[model samples]
Target chain A: MTTQPHEHIVKSYDEEQRRLVEEIVRMGQTAVAQLEAALDVVDRRDDSAARRIVANDDSIDAAERRISQDVMRLALRGPMARDLREILAGLRIPSDIERIGDYASNVAKRSIALNASPPMPHVAGLRALGLLAAGQVRQALRAYSEDDDELALRVRENDAQLDRQYTALFRELLTYMMEDPRSITPCTHLLFMAKNLERIGDHATNIAENVWFLLHGDRPLPPRDKRDDTSTAGPA
Target chain B: MTTQPHEHIVKSYDEEQRRLVEEIVRMGQTAVAQLEAALDVVDRRDDSAARRIVANDDSIDAAERRISQDVMRLALRGPMARDLREILAGLRIPSDIERIGDYASNVAKRSIALNASPPMPHVAGLRALGLLAAGQVRQALRAYSEDDDELALRVRENDAQLDRQYTALFRELLTYMMEDPRSITPCTHLLFMAKNLERIGDHATNIAENVWFLLHGDRPLPPRDKRDDTSTAGPA
Candidate 1:
């Protein structure tokens, strides 16, 4: 059977939609790379690299603004189910990306302050967490671009692992402080950095959750203790 | 000169607008009081009070939401310049109020974890920070209500004092860790709690900045340097 004119228009629209999704995935990857670079700067005390990351923040900010504007424009133009989901997902992805950049910049600023000092104890654990979180960010973006629901779910699973790592790191840092009080200064700052990474993981998982919602439209994940439904406590 | 009938309507609308602004000030005071209660729960290890504070979150949220909706409705109906600024200020105060609740809940969560343990070192400082921040929140709300730009400016100035207090508290905790490694556990948690209070102060300052913005419609405040900017290169 000959293809109808409406079919041709729909095919073109799908292609354009895919293109937009791809752009967002690329932006996510860029943000992940920025995180990695910032971590490297922190690990190595590379002021030059840290400065570069700081300068690059404006670019990430601009990218996020542009993506948000584009999403708003496309949404106003009317969208089909998949197209609508992609557009909404696009809007949220950039916010996560922007926050990731923010966390990276924080690490970079911390590095600048450390001024080439030796890495604190548990630095390796912090790096590992950073790498894992960066990887999750990239994988989540890929899953969204390909509409791979399973990969998105895996990204969500990884957040728990990151949290566990953070908890362990926190305890280890505490032990170090218990052994030697002098370590407290660097250790406390390190704790904040670790918390920041854990927060980034949380945000990545949030993005993954949004991806899941776009695909399945389920109720957003309930607070962890939904079964403790003593709502008589009311609305907290 | 003969009076226009429309002038009478306009005069009554102005009176109602002023009354709405006053209501927002009252609401803000209630929110600040709620935050103070939440802090007391933490300081006193009062679980029931903590639960009550958590329950009160919904009321704060609801009040803020209602005020926001009201502002939008009023703006849409064509508010004059002064009324418009007052309404916009009203809209912003709730966000600051909500954030205060968030900080209080954070303190409560930490209190729950402390589980009736004797107050940690610098617990007094944390309480001081909370009180100071709660005071600023109250002052900012009152400033918005009365359009007292000078009072708002004074509230903004207090953020620096909060920062100074936070810095001192952090150093004291470091000394504790140095004195005894076991102190690390409670001190680290307390550090996080202190940071949360400091952040609440920062948020209050942010609200004050917005108040300034509303009053003058000028460029926003200069970005404050991040507090975690201290270097590990230095000796504890």
Candidate 2:
């Protein structure tokens, strides 16, 4: 049977919808890169880089607003099954990206608060956590853009690993504070920075969940046990 | 002009839609109450009350889920103009409510973690902050339900007050930590609890913004500032 004109229009519409989803994923990846760069600023005490991260947040926020508008427009215009899920999922991705930008800006602010210096003894594990979290965020976005549920699941699983790293990092910092009471000032700020990275991991997990919801129409993972994950472990 | 039989059915459908919106507002109110109860638990270190708050979250969660389903069903069936906006707003409200619940749970968790004995210094200010935040949340929900822009704006203003309180509380806690290094453990948990209440205020502001959006179809408030309002006050 010959294709109907309206059907052809819908086919093009689907293409446009897919492109929008891809754009959101790209935006997420950009935000993740910004976060990683902010971590570098934290390590090097690069005030210029920190300021750049803070300023760049506006672009991320604008992207989020644009994506939200596009999603709402798409939903109002009406979408079919798969396209509907993709567009709805697209709405949440930008919020996650914006939050990642917030975390990056947090690290930047902390960097400014604590002037540039050599890596504090307890910061190595925190740095590792940041690198791992950034990687997971990027991977989650890639999995989403490519429609790879297996990759998304892998990204989700890495959240637990990130939590373990954070637990270890916190314990190390706690030990530092216990040994030298004066270390509390920088250590508290460092704790917040670590928390920002952990929250980025959480945003990645949220993205992974969105990917799963788009693919399967249900939450794919069990609710996490906060106690098991957030509790401090033995000295690192 | 004679009305069709289906017109009567549509009228009844509209009634159901209105009821659904009412239910959503109720869910929002319940969430605000949960936050208040959670604050009480934190202030009094009443673990039983905290446990009750935790248990109560499931009910709020279930209510939110039910309202979400209703919104989706109504949207699937078809909604026009005001009905469409109301349903969409109804959908957004629950997610906000669920986040409020999550914040309450965070407060409860911190309460459990701290387990600080009576004479909990630095707590009075935190409790005041929670009460202030809880009030904003309640007023915001009422404004949304009543379509009262004036009340919504009031809620927005209250957010700044909550921020000021959070700053004072943080400074007080910092002093406690500086005075007695051993107080750091409980103080740190108290800090997170206070932070959670402040965040709850932020989310309440978000709800008020959404309410304004629903009423005016435009964002009425300026975008949120990314700075740490808690840390910025000039050393208490």
Candidate 3:
């Protein structure tokens, strides 16, 4: 919650809003860790890491549920003006975090799917690219925790680079599939995981936009700016 | 707007909640149209239809903005009890609808990608599967507008069939690519479109769950039931 000087007028109100921020940060930190573990599963083919991400998802879901209940509870007290925006921002950010968790879980599932396949060269590249995307998620979480719009805007701008990374890796994956038909199965799984990471970056951007709104009330939603992931991605 | 017969405690409050429902119905109707246009693009390789969906997304975004604005305004009025859930549902449903539109647009974009590929035989199968998913979207929207929990629950149950349809298509598309490597690029686009439709169904379920809460008070978010799309999808 952005604190206006007048806001601490109600001490419990300030405390409740602080609780909301605390929940978002806790939820976000867990989600970011989940994304890293999910990628490490792909990079190392570590079944245990993948299972941990999959198992941990339920707790993330629970975290979002707690935040949602808290938001609705506080809204019962009738927050006005900026306080209302803070509650609405609460509604928006958790779903994005929950989805980021889902994407990470999906990646872990892909690890299970690819478990039988022989390792390929591009797994390292996918993780390299994935780390770039993960860093953005971390930054977005920071922006929210600190109410730092400049950091949020930087995350928003750098998202195009993530899209480009996905596009480039997509081409490499396709070439790998084409050159050796046997690579098709595991490669396709990798493709979906790569797309999932790119989307994770987009979800991070979604959170950054909310942070922007939390700081400044109503700005028409920023027109999406970026070469979407398909820019260098094949025919599509 | 689930009516408690004894309570029109504040007439303006009841009307405001009704207006909120009306806005969601309007948003749902436009989204349903966008889904149809998006599917038509896949069926006909219709560029103009795809363009129409891409262009009309602005209106859908506007619709969400209006609802969010209205919800914030009503929250300021201090809705509690049943009215609180209605406002929370308003927060929940529109974001899901906005995402459904984004997926529809992605499908439309995929239509353009496949327009040039020597038409694959599986295109029709994709369209058929897409319609099954679309019908659920329609049903979910109707459930919200009518406050029909049974219809919503039926939508929830039928989602399994959509997942099965997508998994089946994934296997088929993979087989097509393997049989003719030349088919890989186009088939991959179609694969993504199929996945998009599958995700659209997931979004519909997300909305259906919100409908469930709107009608009944607080319920633990249902653990996701049914076959996820990956149930039979091939190796990662």
lDDT of 2 by residue, A105-193 (tens): 87877777655334576566767889998999988898888888989888888788888788777767767766766666677677778
State the C-alpha lDDT per candidate. 0.69, 0.74, 0.81
Judged by whole-model lDDT over C-alpha atoms, candidate 2 comes out at: 0.74
Better of 2 and 3 by DockQ: 3
- Candidate 2 CAPRI assessment class: acceptable
Q: Tell me chain A's TM-score in each of the predictions.
A: 0.85, 0.90, 0.91
> Which candidate number would show the highest DockQ if scored against the true structure?
3
Better of 1 and 2 by TM-score: 2
Better of 1 and 2 by lDDT: 2
How many pairs in model 3 have backbone atoms within 3 A of each other, for residues 3 or more apart or on separate chains, i.e. clashes?
0
Q: Is the docking of candidate 3 incorrect, acceptable, medium or high quality?
A: acceptable
lDDT of 1 at B115: 47
On residues A80-153, what C-alpha lDDT tens digit does candidate 3 reach at each position? Answer: 66577788888889989999998888888788778778887888878977788779988998999899999999
Worst 10 residues of 1 chain B by lDDT: B227-236
lDDT of 3 by residue, B1-236 (tens): 68864465467777887888888878877887888888887788787778778878878877887798788777766546556778778878998899888888888887877886666788888888888888988999899989999898888888988988888888888877777777778877887888888998988897898899888866655565655646214732
Arranged by DockQ, best first: 3, 2, 1
lDDT of 2 by residue, B99-177 (tens): 7887787787667666643357677787888888888888888888788988988888778778877877877877777
